[model samples]
Target: MSTIDHPNTEATSAEARVTSDPVLVSDVVRSDRLLLADNTVKNHVIAATGVSLVPVPLLDLAAIMGIQVDLMHELCKLYDVPFKEKLVRSLLTSLAGAAGTVVAMATLTSLAKTVPMLGSVAGAAGLSATAAAVTYATGRVFIQHFEGGGSLSDFDPVQFKELFKAKIKEGAQVVKSFKPKSTTNTDQTAQTV
Candidate 1:
């Protein structure tokens, strides 16, 4: 009879311990997914800010809606949620109430732009900042839902109403303090080319 040898039981034991704890494994996976999702969210928010800086009230709102819908769609894909355009639009409309404060601010600022000169400058700056903040808040709300294993089908905006408001506050602060990182690599590559 041939004897079978088991090598490195200690290493095997360590591996076994890691596999045995599903919470730890899931946490690591969630962390990685969160990092990727955050990058996706940030890119969408930047797009929203740029589009919202148009200084036209109704027109800016329409542009922001498209950007926000795309943001939610991308988030849904990341979280493996079914993306239904109708439902997304409906849900966004529901969130409009929750985001009323920022929306109202944007509207007023946009109206100011009609006067020209300083008004245009202030309106553009305010719109961009508020636009970024609102997008950030919306992304954070969806992220919290997805993180909790809730899909778009089960997401209740009412449940997250207060949270949405709080996130907006945090987002505004973040946007105000944020300094844009120069695309040095892309800049250098273009120069070389």
Candidate 2:
């Protein structure tokens, strides 16, 4: 019996064998969006409030990456789409843009009819501002969705119970941090009564 050299195995000296791990590659690709969302949220929060909920004293990759990865994975499960994050983000971007444009156009048209001199300028500026605002708002919403986990509505409570619970928890934590520490040391020599 003669054995032929398989390309998948060690081939002739003329060729270099190329190999790949599809699972690992897909995993990394999937993880990247999650990582991006995490960094975006962290950066935005840090810029806005200077507060971070990340576990480490420093905002490192593991905490940020883990939260986003878990969130994305969970969202994928909850959503019916095969690739949830991308689909959801794209939809959000488009919807936000459309809504912004409509509102801007309507407001501008109304103002233009009422104000004679500012008509043309208002229309142009309104469209431009609408485009910019939509992009910014959609990006913000995307980051917020990932950071909040599940949905933006998850952070936005429609019912009072959830809001009240969150407020109570926040208050309790604040009160815990503010509790007074008693000093036990008593010096009689300093009493000059």
Candidate 3:
């Protein structure tokens, strides 16, 4: 009787782990470049907008849905819950507010150059109205998207509300406990009073 010997995969995997250089420099370099690019864009926006640089929330919604703790940790490192909420609100507001001005100027400029026969005022007004409609539609869509996320209306609204209330109560307690040291002059004034 002849017996066929199969190679053991587990032993091979164990042997491979010892020799593998897990730290890949190319991957590190790429990640560093991405970080640099992100910083550059953030700096440019901050310089132009005069707003503090708020990092984008690092949570992958897909990963969160899959219940990945590592992704949650990564997100916490990038943005806290309150800051993430604030960032979303800020983005929504900015997109809603800026759409009209940008669209109006671009459309008017384009129309004015393309159809010289149409007097500037008429062309500008037509373009401006078109831009306004587009902006309104865009803003509405953005708001709808924001509201669709249901930050307030959810399965565990009661629990979340209680948690929020508890946090506020805790904060109030902490504030109440904080006592500013009375200076000598303040003590003297108190004594006089």
Best by lDDT: 1
lDDT of 1 by residue, 82-151 (tens): 9998998888878767778777887887777887789888887788888788888889999999999998
* Clash number for each model: 0, 0, 0
Tell me each candidate's TM-score.
0.78, 0.28, 0.22
Residue-level error in angstroms, candidate 2, position 57: 50
Model 1 scores a C-alpha lDDT of 0.83
How accurate locally is residue 1 in candidate 3, as Cα lDDT from 0 to 100?
A: 28
Candidate 2 wrongly placed segments (more than 4 Å)? 1-113, 147-149, 156-193
Candidate numbers sorted by TM-score from highest down = 1, 2, 3
- Pull out the clashing pairs in model 2: none
lDDT of each: 0.83, 0.39, 0.35
**Candidate 2 C-alpha error for residue 127, in Å:** 4.2
Off by over 4 Å in 3: 1-109, 113-118, 150-193
lDDT of 2 by residue, 1-193 (tens): 2235455344543244333323577467557756765454333322222112222222322232233334334444433224445554445434433454444453444344334445545543443333223223333444444444444334332322233333333433433443476654454435633
The best candidate in terms of TM-score = 1
Candidate 3 lDDT over residue span 1-193, tens digit each: 2223536666677779976868788678656644643343233222222111111111211221222122222333332222244444344334323444543443444345344444444444443333323322322232232233433122132333333334333433433343366579888989999
